[model samples]
Target: MKSYEYIEEVKRANGLDTDYKVAKLLGCGQNKITQYRAGQTMDNETARQIAEILDIPVWQIIADMESERQKDPSKKKAWKMLAKLSKQAGAATYNLLILNSIISFLVIYYAL
Candidate 1:
């Protein structure tokens, strides 16, 4: 996703209605958000903060920002793939937790 789109997603996910609010949440200046909207690629620290705000894995955001900044097509593609895989991994982890809970419940029920 582009920086602007990413910022918008952050806003939506965190209930922030404006750039200023997002900046405050991220501990950045509003101009930084504006710069992102205008196509400025975010640094790693900013990406990390965004991940925290969105409750997502930091690597995913880092990869996304790197993909946006990368000039080499191959490297950019790799970064995009990394971001996609990380998202999938996060989902799988959630599913695994749910499955583990179900199994634990089943074991306890059978034990009784």
Candidate 2:
């Protein structure tokens, strides 16, 4: 997702009414948030924090942000690929967790 989209999601999820509140949560100034909204690439640290807040893979966020920051076509392509792979990995992890929970529930039910 784009940086602005991430900020919008954060604001919606956290009930943040303004960029200032989101900035406080992100440990940055409101202008930084504005910059991001204005199409600036978010820094790595900010990406990490956003990942934590959004409960997504840090690598995914990092890759996405890096993709935006990269000027070279090859570098941008690589970052985009990394972001795609990380997103798939995250989905796989989540599916595994769900499967594990189902298996555990079945085992417990059978034992009882």
Largest TM-score belongs to which candidate? 2
Q: Which stretch of 10 consecutive residues in model 2 shows the poorest summed lDDT?
A: 47-56
How many angstroms is residue 76 displaced in model 2 relative to the true structure, after the best TM-score fit?
0.7
Give the number of colliding residue pairs in candidate 1: 0
RMSD of 1: 1.7
Predicted model with the maximum lDDT: 2
Q: Candidate 2's residue-wise lDDT over 58-85, tens digit each? A: 9998898889988999999999999999
- lDDT over C-alpha atoms for residue 88 of model 2: 93
Local distance difference test, candidate 2: 0.93
Score each candidate by Cα lDDT: 0.88, 0.93
Clashing pairs in 2: none
Residue 85 deviation, candidate 2, in Å? 1.0
- What TM-score does structure 2 among the candidates reach? 0.92
